[model samples]
Target chain A: MVTLNNFRKHYKDFDLNISMQIPAGTVTGLIGRNGAGKSTTIKAILGLINPDEGEVCVFDKNPREFTPRDKEAIGTVIGGNLLGDFITAEDTIAILRKMYADFDEPYFRAQCKALELPLEKPFKDLSNGMKARLRVLIAISHKARLLVLDEPTAGMDVIARSEILDLLREYLAQDGERSVLISSHISSDIEGFCDDVYLIERGEIVLHEDTDTILGQYGVLKLSENEFRDVERQYIVACKKEAYGYACLTKEKQYFVDNYPGIIVENGSLDSTIILMLGGR
Target chain B: MRGVLEKDFRSYRKTVLLTLALVVLYAAFCCLMPGFDLVHSVLFVGWMGAVAAVNEVADDERNGYAFLMTLPVDARSYVLAKLVYVTTVQVHFWILARVTLLVGTLLDGKKPDIPALLSKGLALHFGMVALLMLILTFVIKFGVKSILYLAGGLVMLVCVFCVLVVTKPDANWVDALLRIGRFPHIGIYATAAAIIATAGLTRLAVHFMRNKEF
Candidate 1:
């Protein structure tokens, strides 16, 4: 369980004010574009950056005040390259084994082998996909109750990405006590795995709701110039216009589809929904 | 804590080895060359301090190992681990120096009392470690290169002051060290205690770093 209450952090150029909660036994996705403060949110939660205001608690304990037991229950992977270029996968495992008492070494080794990561090669020597997989393997091997991942699949190929997704699903399925919070630019990954989605824009949360509910409710409305001119302003959430037509977006996609049967309708993907909600695709 | 130290050890193995080799070569050169005991000791201390200071400052964060920040490791443990590593490296170099000195004396048929040498070395070792710890605190608080520049300037200032102090007809090098190294044993103890206290302050810095949102 994690809770952030009116958390605010400010830099010279950027600011973050967020209020969020991740309930136990549920996967939450943090969705945002580049420079949208997704990483800042994760950093604030990890206590890597002290919040200028508000509070963050993990399993009811503040990150700054976590007891040993509380810390032991949490694991985090903040980057696709958790181990630096000079460190090898074997070196990472050895160091982790000593730091985390509950680390499952054999299981971790098996995962590494299956993932085809070279244990003895330095991290810089590995491909980006290999490094990403290795990072996930390290985080999951800790036997932690909560796993926080930031862009863990950002550099992987389609197959590698699917493998990671499958591994995460398997983790949730087998371990009922565990919860996950993963942030990625890939909207489909978030849609496929996250139970709830948090869409952030310019350091503020725009929406937090069930992934399916948001996806099902929003759609794009393609209109010719005359039709766009005739449409109600209030109904159009966002519109990208050109000489040929206007591509209008609306939150009441189902209503638009049923009422305007003659108009063209396309099933809205998560990406489009975010683009509309954030007012930028 | 053991984990942190082990990782630091493995990570900086190259630097540690190189430092050891340099210390041995310097000590041997000091013994072989005539009348350089005091200069050798001071240079040895300075060299070891510089190496320990740089390694302490740069090895972790520069190498992208800040993910260690996510672990349950306490700030105190991180500082202690660094101190332990510097001290361990110091001990290894000290042992190598003693062995080299003993072998040199054996070949020359001039055996100094081992107990007396050991006592002096132990005192010097504790003092050197304390110095390294205090210097490392500053290095971590500032950037390594900045600290190195500041230290160099300070050393130059001290050398200038020493020359100013000993501009008399009979002020030899031995007299200079004797005059300089002479504060009471209490002064050394007090300085060592201050160094150890700085380690606590460095822990707070680590906490600030860990909690820094980046």
Candidate 2:
């Protein structure tokens, strides 16, 4: 649904160089630490800011050139405070209904009602979790073909997060072609909800693979100093010294299991993978 | 554009109400005060319109302009909507000011100087439109925070120019202003010029907004 080709943007303290594709009918998660260019990449894709070089295409057209009709196919939930303090939920719905021809007002109201959001309360008066839910509700209620969510579940409790994830699952299930690109710091959410994941560090894409591959085929092998020295180097993608010994990330989990019978191997997770890949060697 | 205008209206509802109340109070004051000149009231109305425009711009900034950009509207449309809203509010205030002046004059049992009223009202209206357009351009170019510095700098510049004019040995500039006011056609010409200038400024604002990074 969206593609970034050699996208480059330079800031005073950092430079973002990213290339990725978010295919249709799949949930793609972008995981990165703060200042890792996640938001910058999203901004460039949204045409909120122009990149110094390269191109971003959404639905085969540059976002900078998107007409209102083209934009109606995309929805977004950006992080931080969005609505003004004076605007209430009712006012938001009224405004959005006029802005989007396909805006599903009933769906939005139903979602808000289900979430127990006060329709008359000003946005500033809502709790952080409520605000997050409201953003998600608005994004999904527009009947958009793609939903670009940045930290959509941030500040929400476990129950709220679970509910939102379920809502996204249902939303995708309703249409085979709908897609989502979500960026969040919470690895568990990405692991649980995403079909594919991209690990970004210092504006560079370190890894992009299917979630199943990361969880099943990739692994971390725990070894003592002596054992680590004897282990084959070809299987290790990244390694980090630990308090007990060392942990090495391996893409070929079967090779490690078959060759090293006594080695301790644990299933790879997004968090552990990021730590080994981004942490100092 | 309608969405944008509606958002602004709801956001500024309180301020609009406050402005209306102030206009009513000022009109009442004008009716009671002996030898009350409507020119000062016209200027006050102009200031009120400017205040509304500035407040709307500030509110949009504070409300997260980035969020607005994410909507299914382009930057040009956003800028145009703001221009339309500000112009509508200014026109509304102008009508209110005219009605107040006329009612006050009638209540005071005075034969209103129709020509003088038109001359001052038209001048004030033109000035307000120019001021609003300039402000909109600045807001689009530099964001809302710059408005304070811009307004302060403009006030200082105007003050310096006024001082220079008052201290000048020649009275020609003052005489020229008086002479222009005497010609009723000058009001129509100034109105036409103000409209043209506002249209040009709106186009400039749209250009600035198109290049602006959220």
Candidate 3:
């Protein structure tokens, strides 16, 4: 279990006050716009940066308490270059084998083969998608108890993306209690694999719920200006008034669907749902 | 720690090979050149430390190799590994130089100011090594380029001081250093021990570095 308790960090332009719990044995998607504190939150949990307030515990252990052995339990690929670009993939594996007690050479090699990443090539020489795959492969090969990946598919083509997702799903299915936290800007990728999604806007978690619950419960309700004036405003999260009248985000889609027979209500995609929930006003 | 250390060494194979080549080339000069200075060992050791420390510090972070710093490896272990690497190279070159100089002296069938030069050289080398170890530790902790600029500034400052030292005919720098020579009989042994002890101080430096966050 990964618990983020009232985690707060402040910058001159932004403040991140987020709290969330990620259950074990499930893939939790951290969905946010760029600079929405997703990477900052991840960096805090990884101990790359210290938080101003709040605590993070991964598997009941504070990240600050992380020893080499404790770190071996977590595998991660962040947005920035994680490996030294000069090292060949083969050299990287050899070094990782020494750092991780559970590093399986055969598994790493298999992943490389599956991904078709040349072992002898320097990391700088690999294409961005290939590098992303290699990073995932290396992290996964450690047999980590927790996998934290940030934008693992950002540069991947459809074929490579599917293969990577397939590998992640396979890894998740092999064990009943493994956990993963993935952050991506592409809503479709998150919608494809994540059972739950945490939507962050301007450093705050605007919505945290199971993927189906959000997609099923919240929707865009379009209505005429005169019609919206008569409807109760309490249930409308935010409304955009236009020439056609008003398009509002309703917290309870079913209620609007049942109450406003004449209003236009439609199921929203993850991207629009996030946009409505975050930047609706 | 060992894992990261191995990784650091493996990544710098080219640099290591180059340093070794320099050491060999200098050792050859000591053996073949007339008026051969046994200070060859000291010079080689200093060159090794400078090359290894500067190269590692300057390139690692810029190349984005430091992403591994987030892993469970202690920052100090990372720093210590560099110190250990530099010291190891330094000691190897020192021993090789000493052995070569000893062989050259035996073949010449004469004691050629080896005792005096060795004694003074050892003291200066060890003192410089102690200071270099500390400097490199902080360099690894802070940004490397920042350290390089600082080092460059320091070198320019030292160059001015060297000019002063050289121009001052009244300045008895050699005499001042050699005053600590108590027993001329064991001078060679004492010098050897000083060089070895300088290598030992790196352990203290490594301990300090292991606890750092960078």
Which candidate wins on TM-score?
Answer: 2
> Which residue pairs clash in candidate 3?
B76-B209, B76-B210
Q: State the weakest 10-residue window (summed lDDT) of model 2 chain A.
A: A78-87
Over the stretch B1-214, how does candidate 1's per-residue lDDT look in tens digits? 7777767766666346666667667766766765445334534644574474456445555544447767766666767777787777666656655665565555556767786445444455555565565555554555445566767987998988667666753668646655656755644575576567656655655654444433
Question: For residues A87-182, what per-residue lDDT tens digits would candidate 3 score against the true structure?
Answer: 788888878878888888998898888789999988778899988998888778878888888888889988888899999999888887888999
Candidate 2 interface RMSD, angstroms, 1 decimal: 1.6
Give TM-scores of the second chain, every candidate.
Answer: 0.71, 0.86, 0.66
TM-score of candidate 2 on Cα atoms, chains taken together: 0.94
Using lDDT as the measure, which candidate wins?
A: 2
Interface RMSD for each predicted structure: 2.6, 1.6, 2.6
lDDT (C-alpha, whole model) for all candidates = 0.73, 0.84, 0.73
Q: After superposition, how far is residue A255 of candidate 2 from its true place, in Å?
A: 1.8
Error of 2 at A254 (Å): 2.1
DockQ of each: 0.47, 0.64, 0.43
What digit string (tens of lDDT, one per residue) describes model 2 on residues A1-281? 89999999888899999999999999999999988888888888788888799989999988888877788888899965565777899999989988899999998999889999999998888999999999998889888999999999999999999999998998889898999999999999999999999999899998999999999999999999999999999889999999879999999998989999999999988888989989936
Task: Work out the iRMS of candidate 3.
Answer: 2.6
Ranked by lDDT from best down, the candidates are: 2, 1, 3
lDDT of 2 at B195: 81
Candidate with the larger DockQ of 1 and 2: 2
Worst 10 residues of 3 chain A by lDDT: A78-87
* Candidate 3 structure lDDT: 0.73
